[model samples]
Target chain A: MFDEHENGYFTEETSAEVVAARNAKAEDERLRDCVNILVKHIHAAIKEMEPSQEEWFKTIMFLTETGHTCDDWRQEFILLSDIMGVSMLVDAINNRKPSGASESTVLGPFHVAEAPELPMGSNICLDGKGEPMLVRGRILDTDGTPVADAKIDVWQANDEGFYDVQQKGIQPDFNLRGVFRTGPDGTYSFRAVKPKFYPIPDDGPVGKLLRSLGRHPYRPAHFHYILEADGFESLTTHIFDPDDPYINSDAVFGVKESLMAKFDLIEDRAAQQEAGFDEAFYLVEHDFVLAKG
Target chain B: MFDEHENGYFTEETSAEVVAARNAKAEDERLRDCVNILVKHIHAAIKEMEPSQEEWFKTIMFLTETGHTCDDWRQEFILLSDIMGVSMLVDAINNRKPSGASESTVLGPFHVAEAPELPMGSNICLDGKGEPMLVRGRILDTDGTPVADAKIDVWQANDEGFYDVQQKGIQPDFNLRGVFRTGPDGTYSFRAVKPKFYPIPDDGPVGKLLRSLGRHPYRPAHFHYILEADGFESLTTHIFDPDDPYINSDAVFGVKESLMAKFDLIEDRAAQQEAGFDEAFYLVEHDFVLAKG
Candidate 1:
């Protein structure tokens, strides 16, 4: 016969310190240290928040949905960080600026690794699709010395406002994208259509994330850049056009006070005539300074 | 007109400290702290590994997919942490040690909030289905004293080994689930069908995460518990039956050494007769434990 009622019985459990001592036998010291710290920090945060079980589940579910939204073309986690401004914040923290130095901005998610090499003066406008625009810039150091042979990789949305990645099959493989090396005088120039503002991808979980966070998912009109050279710290930044409506509030938080470049109107009708183009004024000169590493 | 040039740029950028200084204006201090620390560790790992762009993208893509796969029923991020053994490692670190005390385990995603209350000895087999079974246990402190009126929330799959959340409409609401209060003698009992081993939900992003990580998604047949009292540290653990195939390697790494309870055969005809049960032998057991707050 089984007796159902039994009282007074307890087990003296071991202490956490004892278990920790026992676990000191683990072979991977680095991994153990890393995991222990990570665990401690995460647990500290959890204890501080004391979130309800429902809230905890919601967080887990949010993460799960983020994973489901990922693919080769879309990275929702990055987008999540982008919208939250965490990516730009991290970039800013890592790339601090000295006084009077050009500020670094976020490296937007759309940079392609390899761009076709183009000569300084060769027009990079493969599609000739947007309003005929010329981007001329000088690369200078802090003291204004021309830094020659600086590698400049640039890409932007066409006038219709679409990056190649956004419309892969529809656009030329490298439409409006090119890599140019600065000339001896620290000068670089290129011809491409004016880029228009476009909304970040909103068809996936990121859209939901944006909605949940009460924010829009639109980036301002800007040109992406990767500037690198020997003896200089590489800069991954974006040059936002001041004219874009969202210039002051890019969804990805990529705009920076120093990264904004003046796009001047080229009013030389004679020059337009000489170039065999329409009399339409277009974007012209801007320059960047690179400090000695 | 655009010029084409190959490679030619060279320049030295600003010092790291200068860059770090200007980027210090973080919008939110709390967010900045979290992100900066995360970036430091993650980037350090990246620097150490020196993974190429493609490899980095793959990891990003993996994270993105993990987010997309999360939902109410399945949590891919938890699955990710589980496969990485991070969850169990964290639990192990946090739960520390209590030699004879029940070991903590992974808090799985299937737990639903607000289980219905049941009187001690009330059958929780709502659907009137599943193999006949009974579970009973006593509450005791480390120093051997009856802990009266302890709350116990218990849930598990049916004999067919499916939770109500898994079957949705097919399962009667709250089937095989109940919350009980220990009697004055520190004992609680319930009747239900024996839990059958079943696969974790594999249709969501958790499945994709598991597949990608080369991990199986299966939890051993066990009963979930959340026991608490005014003076004792709350216990969130599972009782794993020795007979389950997954007793050793729960997909979520939730099984603990101290939490394993043997299901003893009860074939005494007199006991069966007293309980108004069939002649077939079944399992029975109780776990006594000390409570430390």
Candidate 2:
């Protein structure tokens, strides 16, 4: 009688073995194979940790609450994966670039599908709220040759330290956001106010989660970029300001030594006039190398 | 500047890998090592599933709710773990008996630390609310020699399907729960009411968990037993009635082919008179085998 529906009960139909095979057999053989392997190892781990009846019940409740706490805006499972470092592991395994090539960090929660296209040197910071800054960078290939026509998608926080998404009504529609195409010489220049440090959303379940785990919600000031072009690998990198207090202790473990660049404070009037800024200016320059696909 | 310590930030003082390499560690480093390995693997598993931000936050919330759902009568985490099959996994790993020995199973949530002691052949049915039953069994070594003076902790639900724990106010203390000692020949006999099927508690977080996962909460009718002796391995086993409706689908995945037993109904008037019972009776005989230490 037990063998009749073993497909739904155990991985195998036969009870020849004293122990039950711990997973259900899926109709698709490949999915079944994956699930079987996962279930077997999971059961083996559980067997090793002989928790009492009360302990078992508590685990069930935890998983249930994980589902209930989910919504369109908040993803507790993703946060659970991130803090537990699962997301990084999977990302690392999938994106194994050779040494000297830039490493990929988390895409983060603020990325939108589209951004407004702007001129090569137009001010992306429409809010006009921070010390004027000029960012200049060259997109290069593995051999250090310039990659013309590279697309640089960039976004950062405003002077008050909030993304447009977080302060929808308070901030302008595209505050401190733009997509710029590199000039014929592989040079891309942009104007924006200095980015400021901000906290990840904290009023929802993630906030309660951070509080319970005794972790803070702050992220250091950094510029987000996704540079893509033909024949070169797309590079997703962040430029962390050396002065940001949370640079070494980014909550998402995103900061890298190669990603840090100093924003040199320019006091010379000649340099300021050339850059078209009257006040003291901060200048940042870094070249991004794309790995060959 | 990023490396300097801040007032509110915290950091790990010592790394376990370094401590494990030193000779000054505690004598019970094995347990510590085991726990470290477990935590590493568990965390690794979580990282692999890069859940979204909302999902991550929900997981923490779920864990908090699991703790809040616990009370003196119900432990949702334990029930959760049980359904996840972790409890049985722990039991299997801890109890590695040779063939022919009584196999161990989950100790269900209904077990109390203490039960009333009863003499040989005494009836455990204080409420007299179940079908008349006589239970007799022999405790044996793996090679078939009887084990003398073994203590058997036994309990079962009443015919209407309620445990003493479920009805603390109405049912007498330790009703249908007894601690019986084997006679000189490793023989034990007791009269009791037949056990009945019952639902696990559904009002707590575990219930909410089951509802979310689309799982039913039920267990088959059965007798619970824990047999212990001086020089032999302890045995925790259940004698599940094959006729119960839930026999095929015990919620904890606890039913084994060898653990099922038959209960025969007897209408013999002479035997009923000798036992001082009504005209109808039920007889059940079971044998338990303990593994050699």
Candidate 3:
């Protein structure tokens, strides 16, 4: 039988335990654990800060605004999580890879499911305006064997640093998005324009917070990819251009050395002919290895 | 100078530190400190939880829903804070009281400034619904000296446990809310119905969270008050009915032993006549002590 007189009441000293004790034993294990973890840490933070009433209310308002700013077309909370390095942390925790597999990173927010499916060696730069580049990569298993029929979905910002979705009418639908399935040789290739660094939406509450923190909102220019094969784990990752100025300071802390790829200048005529480009072009070649599920 | 090769990239081991370092040298000191506190604790929580990607995104969605639930008429976030014990924690931190001074608690979210200012001993219950109660008190300084002309704004739910605003059409406007000032003798009196224990709105994401945690949303029967006097600190607090079943376990953890008041049945005709009531009624008396600013 429970003690009738014993109750957890509000006090500065027992605040966390009181809050966390609300979780009943009948609750889902996952939720109980998560909420308890959150309660303990949030209370700890509040205790450490001892924020004034005004400051506490300001935080309440910030959370309100961050939540209010989310809608069907935009998710400001995820943006908040991303900028705070939470999305990356969660990604890292969930997608921990084996020693030789490609390291996974953030999937970002611009991916669209209906990106045009195309054949290998097709050009995704429909409105080509920047330096022509050939992106080639093979799908391999960790054991050095080719993984055939692997699907690679890729998307990137335009040369002007805008995604097709961000520009809407300005950029044609699916302008810089494509999907390809590798063949028996496990090789996949496509043509694209060099992506430009772009700023995240800085007009919302998250943006205001970023400004207040003296942090810039631009992410380093990179190509996004989601790779999948029949018996292997699907990978959500990005391929960072090493020469980009913002490589070291991604707004979301998503950059990793293993995910960095070299962009080489190809000048040989045979190389140009093989890639079906008339002149010298940039070649970004990086192979990806996947672990079986 | 910054090194070109070094970056605080996303890594599970260094996530919190990386996020905290993003607060640049030029940012506001207070904001930087608060954000760093938040970043560190949030990362610690995530690290402990190791929440799956779906679970993390569900949290993002929950936040968005909580935010979307707020509007000009309601503030779901504050309610969320209340049920989580955060609002009370923040209030306690900001209102640390001296010995012999009245303890402070949550202001709650239902207070309206439009409550009518009334004479002492006026009945706040426009509708004769529940047991009539005679409530009286004196406002005094920490030294027990009467503090004349002190303002005591009081409000509470009706016998049916509904605030005027919550039952707008059913209850008269300002039915149980009033503002009163003490006399030269520091005595203040009011007539009202004994408030019933009531549950907070259980229809939002916060409610879902509460239900999932096996917690009830009911707050004990209590009268809310805000006291202010010249040369003294303003106090936001509550006086709880000791007989109420939920008195010890408030949903928001707002209850403190010092804030409890005893209600006695007054059956003497002379006393009832003195209270201007034709029949026997309940009498609850509690004095407040405020600290000098």
Candidate 4:
């Protein structure tokens, strides 16, 4: 079967085709398709770039260093994918939701498996270093029906732009992280410090690539949420503050128009006191709509 | 400049454009072009594959594992590039020579810096295993003129398909490796054992990928050669024996019709005696042509 050519070796013109043809008898159909498309695009890129041997070696070294930088606390390859906007692209391709449904974004490498569960309106900020803020949101289906008994997992960086996990000893455990359950009304609220824009780890190969490309490593100031309910597709998304300077230039290309929230400052003492803040505070009200499974 | 869009965030339709736009101000023109093309093709692949989150994560894990497998002696990422035919493609792109010139293949990951220089007709096989073979080659320029004093650095695996470096203590040092200089006639000759086909390292991520793709890991029996001389472009290539079963399906895609050589078995006792062989032997007569610098 392989004797079609006297010396059927690789060539630039048929490189991708040859590689893809080798997968003709793949055991898994999905694997075959995945490898075929991957090889095709890789060869396309190579033809477009015509990278020299040195350039190719440089890429291999960059990948090796990126992998070496990853451990239990760091995932450099994910950061590479995120910085290249591949993560966001994949997410967008997979999550084609209804018009009114909330858009999804990249699930960054920072989510902890078990965050502390708190009651509604409980403060998540333990350091008290940032402006107090109140966030209220309702979980609803695309049909406008409330999603009862939904769970909202929220986490964010402090005003100093550092997550609790990033500054382990300095920040309180589970700082700016909490899980809240929605009532039968599908409403959930929580109080926490305003999130801050922060740079992704820039000391590794991905950072070097960002610098070389004249791009910043800062993601926009935002809060992360993982909302799940029965009979609805789980939504992993971010709520960006409109005031953030990086909103239009998120390093990871994770910003979405539907996910931006307007933060309103409450100067009136009555409103602040009603919100349980002793002074002026900010409030963000946004609704999340999930698609039915 | 980043404030052009109210929500100028990334979307599926504009992922690659958004990523490439970030490099608009790159100081290095080469880096800009490289990143631009890379980002464009990466997004193209993602769109074509539409990989699910699990599939995407699986790719990340595979890359990380490929990276982790690299150390001082091993480079699995290079192996990945090799088996996918990227290495040979890059070589072909970089080494475009005139008609009738010797074509180049992958240098592979096994060449050492220093090979023992031997006089012409010296035997490179120290272990005295397998069938004895003699290789006679002349180095010539593209214009057909002999390249005098040309250096031919040659290396190959034993009949068992293992290089001396792969089995250090078991095999004599530099058992199948030697550097020979051409005389005024631009001709060189050396004695060694016949080469054999071998599988690339298959215990790592690249091997797993090959298995999943239903591709074998075997490369045809070949002798590696790097020919160099004054005023000529150095050539790194291989001479594959046409009789090998895997000639048309080299695992690394390193085979080329122009590089194949026929191994003639010499059963005549007088010829064997003249060639310093006690029994029957094989002979390979191939000439290499180097392009002018």
Candidate 5:
């Protein structure tokens, strides 16, 4: 039905329309809409950039290398999306919440299913490398009602800024990862080493792109959380350490003002002993609010 | 210095800006400009689409598959660009010539270097399975002056829609492919079977995408050419048959109205005998104009 062109040839002026018109017979409406939007935007971008043939080939090569860099463990395309701020943009678009509820961020490629469940006061730092810290938090609904029994799954990098999965044999299987259930008072406390700033896996094409753009690949120190409760929406987010150098310039743009938690150092050995620490440590307190599903 | 972001955090509203700001420190100005433009367009597309998290992941998966489908003999990403019309768009943007000059199109993935050189009036149809055709063309400058000794390289698929390179044993080496030079009058002629419409190498991700978009993988029957001379810009393009069903819907979007040539069936046995053909044949005549370098 798209026989508008008597000669049916391509011209620069109608390139996108010609391509989109070919989809008139597409059986899937979603596919048609998606393809149309994609073609339109791609054409717009090409017109804006006016890329030369060589530059176009360079893009193809970069995308090919990005695909080749992926394996069962690594996803360079995701890294590309993250560094481009696309992941966060998609997350933001998908998760528009009412005020007072915690905002969500990217569920980075590092999360694993079935993390070990632990008591509220359990320590997740099996490495014992960085300065000890205590994190205590409450789970509440948007209107201030307690969300007891909420499952809080957390994970983070160690002092060396390496995840347990990254240093498979060196770090314990579940190093710096745990799942805790909020108590009846909606309170949950965990002891662990302070999170440290870390560079993303930068040995791939995405890393090369970041470097070429004069951008760093370092993300601020942060703890990952996937909080879920019976009637509340599950939240995948990060809690950033306010003192980290990259706090303002996270490589993946995972930091938010509401997600930042202050880490206060405590010099009192007595207080540390009372909290079951053998030496002085730091304290971080922040509450999380979830919206109804 | 991209330290304009006192907070250096990515917000949905400032996502593209934050990414573009990083390029302020790029050493290569061209790279900086290209990257800035790319980031702006990509962010604009994302905001316009507002793709869901699942849809975002689907895109990543598609790109990864497109990359993985490429190897030494094939480039699926290029095919993606070709079918999407991006390759032709780039070519048009880069090769804008004056109104009477020959327009360029995509140099498809099938061209090979070092085709056998032949004198004018040579027959390139080694296998000879289809109706024989004579192609006589003159090479001229945009001013209509002769451009003698211009090298004309041409190749096309056989009657079964397969290139010699694609079917090494079935067809003779370099069948339907040759290079010729214009004589003092800037006239060259060669004999070859009429080219048939051919499907692109569509057993990969690109093919799957085309199927999903309700687009066929068949390009119009056409002859590929790359003409060059000492002081003129080389032209890479195609001469498509006007009667081909896919002429208006070339899978690669490579067809241009000015490039379409009519193939006239000639029933004159006398002319066929004079041209050394043993049966009824076809004739195609066209002229090519090149711009001065």
Candidate 6:
């Protein structure tokens, strides 16, 4: 006895279409489009999976728990996005640089501004807790022209696989993290420990999902970089150590082939003397190429 | 310098495929498939929407807020599903019945297990705050055979569109909610107020989403029912008032054509006497045909 209507009722077969039609009245075109696409995909997913009522309830609870697991100090939803690779995909879609420019990746949560900006060749390894490495790099334009006076902010985890903030009193402040200014020659060098593979924050709903999916939570060892210069598009990326164990399957999918750097070991007398090292150390020399703004 | 692998890296073009390949190791086949489908759709949505980082961040925060809004008292995720029409789809898929059998609908969040059983013809409208109505129906098998001693649990919002639980002490306990059993001839009749359209609990993220999408949160006037009988599947359903304003656009998408029933106003002296009403009352005759378990 229902009256004939334009969009009709929400039958399973016409559900998504009906919703899209109903949402035609939405004022925000972008939001309406986004909502329609999301609704279409989710409906397809449910139709394909045909999850039980209990399974649906479990998903609802999982989302609720994921949200509950987040607080002022932690964000479980971002973790969920990372594990699902949406974070990287979003970065990729948003940061499609010129072919030769350094690729952007996840900035991560550990980065802090106002890092101590040191002169060329200064050591950033305040604690000296891991393999001593010299990170030297030049900031260049996409066409390979060196850019003078570029600011390169850098940070990484220490040997124990923790940021200074995570370890607090256990690690020195700004350990394995600092900023460097490129000289007129567009070259900068700094000393820090070789980065080590580390597990992301686990023991949350995202962690539980990772375990359930037969996935590991470790991100490949890498140094975080945020580069900025005049009239150029700033870049946020990581120079991943190619040899790190989790390099192939980064939990957050943050790795790119062009971003991979060789951490070469050097023990020559001259090199050791220049590095001010008494022992052989890893040397990571990676350059960044920025796109025009 | 990265090693060659089966699925390659997580590039935007192959992001979903790479994740599906990586998850091939998942032990639970069903969960793995579900995860793959969900990831595929989400990636597609992101690609289509290409939400800016700020928009994505807003989404993450919205989800976190939705979760945080949930405690022992409320579930905002379920509200999100309802507004998205996912809840009704899930119920429809899970409760597919035999041909000619009554279709099922959302049970909603207000159902209580221990609703006091009342005799047929007894009034369930404890508050008597709405238009009086006599509900008569036969519980029958699919072949039109009467099903004796069938349990019919019923509940509805009052004229003010609030469930008893929602009003607490303001409305008498068990207002317009009760259980009844079919007699030997499978005939059952009861008196209750005609349900009024109501907005779902909306002071949360789901409500914000509805307002954003230019949709209202009101469900059409309807009475909820859960019917049970021997050798047949228990049915959860609703009888929609065909003339309800929101019938075509139920926020939860809970209505179906076959579930619509006519609510005729009967002012005849004899019918009013029979309904035990001194004023005009609505009369609804709807039978439930159940499917074998």
- Each prediction's number of clashing residue pairs: 53, 40, 0, 0, 1, 0
Question: Candidates' interface RMSDs, in order?
Answer: 12.8, 8.6, 2.6, 2.6, 2.7, 3.0
Residue B262 C-alpha lDDT in model 5: 80
**TM-score of chain A, model 3?**
0.95
Docking class of 3: medium
Alpha-carbon shift of residue B218 in model 2 (angstroms): 8.3
Please provide TM-scores, in order, for all candidate models, with all chains considered together.
0.61, 0.64, 0.95, 0.96, 0.97, 0.96
Q: Name the runs in model 4 displaced over 4 angstroms.
A: A1-7, B1-7
lDDT of 5 by residue, B1-293 (tens): 32324546577799888777766778878888877777787887788788888888999999988888888878999998998889999999998988789999888877889899998899999996998999997999999988998999999999999999889899999999999999778888999999898899999988988888777898888999999988899999999998888777788889888998989888888998988898888899999999999
lDDT of 2 at A195: 79
DockQ values for all predictions? 0.12, 0.12, 0.61, 0.63, 0.61, 0.58
How do the residues A1-293 of candidate 5 rate in per-residue lDDT, one tens digit apiece? 33324435567899888888887778887888887777888888889878889989999999989988988788899998888778888898888878899988888877878789998889999988999989997999999988988999999889999999999999999999999998778998999998888888999988888788777888888889999999989999988887777776777777788888888988898889877798878899989999999
Reference-based lDDT, residue A105, model 4 = 86
The DockQ leader among the candidates is 4
True contacts kept of each: 0.12, 0.09, 0.74, 0.76, 0.66, 0.63
lDDT (tens digit, per residue) of candidate 6 on A239-280: 998878788888888988899998899979889888988889
* Alpha carbon deviation, residue A44, candidate 1 (Å): 13
Model 2's CAPRI class is incorrect
Per-residue lDDT of B1-293 in model 4, one digit per residue for the tens? 44334335687888888887777878999879988898898788889888989999999999989989999889998999998788888898999988888999989877877989999999999898999999997898988888899989999999899999999999999999999999889989999998998999999999988888778789989999999899988999999988888887788889888999989999999999999998999999999999999
Off by over 4 Å in 1: A1-75, A80-154, A157-189, A192-293, B1-30, B89-100, B126-131, B208-214, B288-292
Predictions in order: lDDT:
0.65, 0.69, 0.88, 0.88, 0.87, 0.89
TM-score of chain A of 1: 0.83
For the predicted complex of model 3, DockQ is 0.61
Report the Cα RMSD per candidate. Answer: 9.8, 7.7, 2.3, 2.0, 1.9, 2.4
